[model samples]
Target: MKKLMMICMSLLMVIGLVACDDDTEGMKKVGIIQYAQHPALDQAHDGFIDALKDEGFEEGKNITFDDQNAQGEGSNAETIADKLVNDGNDLIYAIATPSAIAAAQKTTEIPIVISAVTNPEDSKLVKSNEKPGGNVTGVSDLTPVEDQIDLLVKLAPEVKSVAVMYTNAERNSELQYEIAKKALEAKGIKVEAATVSESNQVQQVAESLVGKVDAIYVPTDNMVSESIANVVSVTNEHNMPTIVGEIAMVEKGALATYGINYYDIGYLAGKQAAKILRGEAEPKDMPIEYSSEDKLEMGFNESTAKKLGITIPEELLKEAKIVK
Candidate 1:
């Protein structure tokens, strides 16, 4: 009777092992490649995960996420992209332009949803915004460069000249620079420009602009965003008000900006990922999405304003969201 009981237990163990294997095979995997560790990108990552959760893709159950950060290095992003592609993720979420470009170069089979990328077509990640023509489509965090500049004028009416600071390596930054230069010229604001090839150069570059320009215009450049503290240290000392491309910079110590919510952009991209995972759509056919104009909000740093002795205009203060 004891021998018979042991045999029965062995058969049950084998059945359980088979069941577990089947469950593992059925689990879907998603890989996330974030370009940097800034708050804006961090918010986007969390929003994407929350979106997947809301869509019933519960972690440790039906889905798993292999999230990797490139540590603001392009090579790291390329390596991480290769790993995600090799691991056979059902879908990949890329948080920045570099990460998205890395993943797009890695695989055509895996659907890639990107957030915070300015111009997909310009980046060559997609054939066109209207038709992706490949397995890459998501949300763009393209802030209104003109509107942001106009907001700067309203906040600091004394700004007769402006310095545009950005990292030269970023294609999107270059794109914004061109538009901003034209807009600044159009508005009759003399534009002084500076570029940094590396983050370590940001502080020196910003310092060089001191006393040369009345204000600084920093676009949503990843390197500049990551090294914003360095930029603000110089600006704050000079009481220079820096108008930025996104709210995250304002929160970090820059003066103000009119931009889209990074979380909203990520959530929208997550929804796009869900549709592809559900077989309801393909990325190639999915039109690239953008945050609605209504979603853009003006953000101000009250502490920075007070430190710079720049009085916030009453009407503008009422319209802007003060950073806590």
Candidate 2:
């Protein structure tokens, strides 16, 4: 009888050890789905991971991260989302409208946190900003359209006609174009839109606007942002001044940009994720937050400016972050 009792105690100890192992393995797992590879998106991801670490969820320790990039292909985004879901990630962090849409369609139960999305409502990912009314909520990179238009008028006083280029298929692009048209029109600047459905069409659209408009404005549309180099080359070749939606574009070649710091926006999203993880708030109860501060940076490519025979405004130069 004593031997049997000792054996039973040993069996209970083994079961307790197995239970502890299961609990340890059930630690939080997160998956990040990025729409494309770009400086802005990269910074946002960095900020998010940094925020997670700051909150004590270090990757490969208490948490695991599965990062995937769609490489600018929408179909690839869907595939990545499926894999992440199959992997049973506790949460999914989708960075951009396309990525968010892909993840949202893949799972209704998994909590999705989207960052750097321009217009969630227009993307149909949410019913409204006030109440996302779904399993998704995060930060927006919504640049002030009216403020950007005002900056353009100030930078180039002689600018009469402004040409805007974007991808027509992207809902964010269409939304930004509408805002740009109204804002520029209010300033008595005639706005012309050049739409492209693919990357190959970007150069042609940029070429079509050469010598026709005093300045060109490029919004934070994913398609246009991804093909900015091609558009910038064409615009520079034609000696046309360009305004951009994000500072990264300005650093690339644009004359000036009024937009948000994407990294900070990502950090904000990370904070929201922490809240969700702590069970402090529900996704539907959380409202989509916009960047509180906007940054105005000038990228004066002296060589490009001189090559185009355009003089950089001294006042603007004084306020510029980079004077090339």
Candidate 3:
């Protein structure tokens, strides 16, 4: 009789644990904080949602999303993070480094996932990329600076000097700039960099580079993306060729880029988020992932090429996506 009673109690405890396991199936809230509105960031945000749906967390059914864009302001990221936490979201998806940093600062309890960040370790968002050792983990879109410089030289063989511009406040931009300098110099290309104090300063800085360099290289810097029109105006006037980090900027006015697919990285982050949401994974143990090499695309702007009076090679056009 004593043995039978003990077995019955064990069975009841198992049932309770099973019930707890299904908690994620009912309803969930996901808060997304984006750094700004740009094609790369936009693709990431959309892909993240698609991935969540693929994982069976459909919005308005099992999950709801509270999406907010910082519109290129750093301080707004922190405020948005606080708001998401106060609203009781189950998880926070921070797109871009600024938002991710803000989210990490907001709460250690809430599982924070990031996308489009460069280096989690340098940013202090995670203890280490391999172990994380904290409540934050996500995908990084680290720029392939060396490959980009090679592309620039290949596309414009006469590009003796390249002007690089980025926002000074961004650590990732500074890192890429330093990388570009060494890479370009090795290939016998002179590298000059200008610092934009803020978005408004991009134009003056860009205009300052006219006639000084043969081509310009723009990194995946948020401020430059936000006020890209200013840089575009200056470059177009000078017929300067600009090689950027992604397609959207190339489409806008830059010459070309061989860069990561932002959507793919975002989708990767969402899959990780689903694991956390379902209680199958914890932030501390999940390793940081990067976008695969095959996911990258080579793109060139035909309209900008025409405007600059430069004829793209037939072989190059066949392989690259020509954006008009």
Candidate 4:
């Protein structure tokens, strides 16, 4: 009878261990790989985390996150993605173009949701925004390039020649440059291309444009955005105003910017992630989203404007979020 009781107790303990294992398996794991540690990317990460929490998947509860940043290096992006895939994450959130491309290349089995990427189509990440046609979809930071150029023209009427500076190797920057070239040409504004392949080249690129153009326009190219202080220092030294692609550029002393809020775009991406998590939708089924009107913000740096001795017209100021 004692031997029979021992066998039953052992069986009960085995059953309890199996139940605990099943319970632990209920939690989903997510991996987030950001291309760089910039303000815009950081805001997106924060927004993504916040959105997940709002969706009832608290970080330590039913969800686990493996977040990593590539520190603005393309090679680092690939390494991070590979690590995430090897770790067997249920879903991957890739921020920025390089990270997205890296993650997509690493795995098609795991769903990838990208944020802050300007042109998903141009980057060949998706077939279309309506139907992504793959295991990848997310939010776009593709603020209307023409609208931003128009704002630049409006801000600097004397800007007959605009110097467009970007990293030549960046696909997103090339895409923006192509669109801006046509738009600026349509307005009879001569657009000069100042291309750089590295962050150190930005200062030389910006300095080279000093006498060649009336004003400079910096796109949201990762290289340029990451080293904007260098570009700003050069442009400011020339007393030339700059119209930037992201709001953080304005905060870094760009004269003005008509761009989408990175945080808000990330929040939108996060909402899409929630849908995927709940199994309400798949990444491939969900169309990529952009910031709505409310999420778009235009910021102007008054100090920078004053430093450049450029008076921002009252009309543009009315439309801008003045940054002190």
lDDT values, one for every candidate:
0.91, 0.84, 0.89, 0.88
Report lDDT (Cα) of residue 166, candidate 2.
83
Report the C-alpha displacement of residue 294, candidate 1, in angstroms.
Answer: 2.6
For all predicted structures, in order, the TM-scores are 0.93, 0.90, 0.90, 0.93
1 against 3, candidate with superior TM-score:
1
Model 1 regions lying over 4 Å from their true place:
1-22
RMSD value for candidate 4: 2.3
Instruction: Report the lDDT tens digits of candidate 4 across residue range 1-324.
Output: 999999999999999999888867978899999988889889989989898888888877689999899998889999999999999998999999999999999999898999989889889999898899899999998877787888887777778899888889888888899999999999999989999997788888888887888988888888888889898898888888888888898898898888888888888888888888888988878898988877677889998888878787877777778878
Between the candidate structures 3 and 4, which one is better when assessed by lDDT?
3
lDDT for model 1 comes to 0.91
Candidate 2 lDDT tens digits, 1-324: 999999999999999999888867867889999999999999889989998888878776678889999998999999999999999888899999889999999998888999978888778888898899989999888887777777777767788999988888778877888999999888888999889888888878888888888889998877787788888888877767788888788777777776788888899899988888767887787889888854434455565667666666777777667646
Show pairs that collide, candidate 2. none
Measured by lDDT, the strongest candidate is 1
Instruction: List candidate 4 stretches off by more than 4 Å.
Output: 1-19
**Over 4 Å off, model 2:** 1-23, 294-319
Tell me the tens digit of each residue's lDDT in model 3 across 1-324: 999999999999999888766765578999999999888999999889999999999887789899999987889998999999999888999999999999999899999999988888888999999999999999998978788888887777878998889888888888889999999899888888888877778888888998898889998888887667678778877878888888888878888898988999999999999999999999999989999988888899888888887888787777688887
Model 4: lDDT equals 0.88
